[model samples]
Target: MTVEPSVLSAVDAGVATLTLNRPKSINALDHPMVTAMDELLRGWAAERDVNAVVLVGAGERGLCAGGDIVAIHRDASALSGSNAGDDEAAACASALFWADEYRLNADIARYPKPYIAIMDGIVMGGGVGISAHANTRVVTDRTRLAMPEVGIGFVPDVGGTHLLARVPDNLGVYAGLTATHLSGADALALGLADHFVAADDLDAFLRTVGETGPADALAKYAQEPPESAVEGRRDWIRDAFAADTVAEIIERCRAVGTEEADKTAASIAAKSPTALAVTLRSLRDEKPTLAETLQREYRVSLRSLLHPDMAEGIRAQVIDKDRTPSWRHAEHRDVPTAEVDAYFAPLPDDLELTINAAPQEDSSV
Candidate 1:
């Protein structure tokens, strides 16, 4: 069956809500959805009737699971065996998608209005790229956030490395390397989420925003609400992820040898060695602002699509439906530091922020 495009956009009561319509795929981002969102966002930015914007998923599970890897598999299959000569062309096409998607991600990072991301379910990888950069990022009890790029033999793109760099006290490295999911309280504590509300209460809260008209009015409506009580195991995360390199991180986890640490270590070990190594080191030193980070990620992402590990990782995880990915480089030491450094190498830096410098006057549109 052919799938329709994933995004549905509408403006109501001065609020523009962009819903991810692919409930069956948990709103996985396909090429069409990416293009649709990019075009729609640019259009909405110029309209005067819109006040605020809310981004959400259509169904009960997630805002977005991630990229449609099955499609990637099909694309890859066409390049194998008798079609080996087509590999370069396929790689270029994949790069184009990365460029467009990363640009869209940068746009969200710099959105002008008081944009809010109502993260209700499993928000991982590319989903974080779209929402984590919003002005007001909200979390519900059901929200699960992670940057699981390494699992797919890809470095964190969609500005994930940039966001992870901004995270405090080495926790970003931990999250990036392990692809561990964070609870609402954990996310808020780590500064990844702004507010935490019960999932059941989310509808009423949004309805109140629709009626209130202004942000101040919405604030007053939510005022005196109970404080968020989501608490996460932060100390362990900080300790486990403190090492400067991927190898060191694994060593630290093994040193602890606790059940949790062992599990974390083993899990990370299962990912692409090159991806984890590069991601850990990159997040440690990546110093781009929101927009700059997205651009940098774009460069690295464009290069990665052609790398053997990315396709192999996707094959194991998504296409074949097997959880075990055989990474090109099985150990952190197997990835040359020089290759890791290349991911951060400067590009022409042609990318521009979609939001520019916030809305000039109230941004109610």
Candidate 2:
């Protein structure tokens, strides 16, 4: 059997369309996929007659579930019980992949043309990286978006800290710590998405967007979204997440003594203790630009790769399909302040985040 290309592209009616073809894995983006995407977008950026670029997934389930953690799991697992010489061999596969992926994200943000992303269904982690950064983002009622990396022993990357940092009243801290899902309206209220269109009108809307243009089609089809969950609960979120530490935040959640607040506390409790500490710190930092934020995230992510939680979290969550993860610390307060601070330490020049970074030939595996 022949394998299909992970991404398929075409130009029509003054529009360039790119369809993510990996429906089986919900278009889980991998290294080659992102590399190919960067190449395509770079060419399209200057091409004539391509007034706009549109991104869509091939299937009904969603835009994308996330990155290929199975591959990252393979790379991270190799680090366990290995010698010093084995460190690069074990870790650089996924590190190289992220280097390219984050660059692609930066490109999308700076694209000259109107980059339109229709986030019609589930968009999580890496999925959010691609679409949420676009110049224009569209969502439907079926949309289910999240950045639930803390559960998997990772701090958010792909400018996730930047985006979440922009959210009002420290709600981003709550969402990041809890690994919560946001509805279409919730996303809009938090400023992650742009317009809302009914699912029934999406087919016609796309065709019109190609034939007419984004502004006119959006004006023709976009409708008022329902009430926002985030907006309704802002006071409650602010009262808790404003605290300095995750422990105090959880205490405030319990002190509130409501169903939602109690559940929010439980969700934070379930994630890796070390991950929670790092994520909170990451969100609180003041990075003036996306590039600067991404540079700092590189340090945190590199440290996470060497930690045991990433592989173990993926093992229990995806590989074994189990719900339990054996984290390094059983409670958030058990993590040391110096250990959390070390995630921000500088790396050697070779591994620094650069303008153009790719894997070594052997890293293709």
Candidate 3:
């Protein structure tokens, strides 16, 4: 019998590297992988010999697609039928997964040593959680970043609400609701990424890090990114997404009467109404700390797990391979205010998120 490691960790020249090893799945995060990473990072954070840490994916396709929602879907499906014992077991498994994953995210945000994430390819949802919190985020021409949880009948988790709330203007709302793909240039323009290195120059850039350390090496290879697709549309994004609610945003977009506005409206229409409504509220928190937002998101995640739309959305998108999802509410306005409010309510002390400490403020980045 043989066992395969989900994460590959190594140290060379005082630099520690963690590679997400499931290339075939675009390094999608499962419970074991998340637990392994959390343990490794905590150990490395306290090690005197480890000067810096680097995170990257094994394949060229992606850094990480997101959490292993397929596994979650399976667990969610087991809640019914004639097995009461299975139901209890599945519920416990699901709760532990979210609890541990959120804790790990908070740890990365407060890491004592320099943490660098080589965000080369697809970075979305849980992927964003791991890399975006790092001290140094490196993006390349191939980077494709988004937080498209609404499409799956889920609000953005893994501290996504925290990061989205901080993006300039109402662009965060636009990105969260519409699930728009941001190129490397777009990510840099939006402050979601730091350095932009061409894909071809990545190996040379990494070798330079091995020779002269990350800061100096990254500075050498970092170049101005190409013009951003998102930056050009900032005016329309601000105007259309500034509304207080998802329904109002869609109305504003329709009123604009432009091709882009119509397309934006169409995209919003396709997502889960309940998820979109909750996402809008989540991103509207008044400049919350990462811990504060994660606590709120933890509540929403558990509530959404029990919601019917989540399972239906997953079935339509993943199992059936159909783009059309049958959301619980047909329109954003159909989602009751009380239902949206329920997601924000506090959980019991046992289930609430607890960070080790406040993240150290760094203005130098």
Candidate 4:
């Protein structure tokens, strides 16, 4: 028997359904998966028969855990090594992965048709990149969403800075820094999710949509979520994370003198100091377009790939499973402003993220 592709695509009526198929890995995205998704989406965008698109994962565990970061770690390591030929090969591979991933992210943000993402189970890092930009993001009670890049010594990329920066108040800062997991209800509260359907009802909802189309079928299933865990803490989250810098934010948390505040402070203290500082600055920039934000993120990602801390971060958190990362700086204050600023610097012309014109509308849909 022939093996199926990592990404499975099918069309019923006018709706195109794309499923991430690596169930064993919770459909963690790799280079081929990203490339396949980009190509399929581009094709479907212009196809008159494909009215809308539904994105989902194949397994019960989650939509996606994240990207194939272990592969990236290997490539980055090779790029930093003594072998010139291996370094060139690794550099090319790394460049292709990020550039294409960011382009796909931009495409989803501007997709003309109703793009619905079923955000079931764990959605983090690259998973967020794919689903968060959808026009209609549906989440089930089982959903757990986050952008936990700081823990791995990387700032949030794949246009995460764009979504985090747009959230109200300073909740984005808290989420990015603490790597807090948001429940389904909390996801809706933060405007990260558009609808909530109970986990048990998901299959029925999908069947109805496949049979009758989305707008009406989705309306039938979408229900008001329960009280959000994040909403209950909004007052303190706003107060503690309101400061301009990571250090100040921690100080504010301590001043509150509450257990939750103390926990938040400790969480921030454990992350890579350089990552925390760079992430704070990325969230603060006032970029006007998703493409612009992605371009800036591309710069940050390349810098992080070369920086010493990223490898160490991945080694401790992922490779060795030590959970004890030896970050370059001891504290957030120790990360120099100049070093943080360098991450956002402009890349060479050939390496910049190139976004084409917005996809044309398909009125026939």
Model 4 misplaced stretches (Cα beyond 4 Å): 79-90, 361-365
Across 113-147, the per-residue lDDT of candidate 3 in tens digits comes to 88889999899989999998888999999999999
Q: Arrange candidates by TM-score, highest first: which order?
A: 4, 2, 3, 1
TM-score of 1: 0.86
Model 4, global lDDT: 0.85
After superposition, the stretches of candidate 2 with alpha carbons farther than 4 Å from their true spots are: 83-91, 356-365
The all-Cα superposition gives candidate 1 an RMSD in Å to the true structure of 4.0
Winning model by lDDT: 4
Which 10-residue window of candidate 4 scores lowest in summed lDDT? 81-90
Give the clash count for each candidate: 0, 0, 0, 0
Q: Which pairs of residues have clashing backbones in candidate 2? A: none
Off by over 4 Å in 1: 1-5, 74-91, 214-233, 345-365
Clashing pairs in 4: none
| Tens-digit lDDT track of model 2 for 21-43 | 89999998998889888887877
Query: What's the CA error at residue 292 for candidate 2, in Å?
Result: 1.1
lDDT of candidate 4 over 145-180, digit per residue (tens): 999899988899888888888888677778889999
Clashes of 4: 0
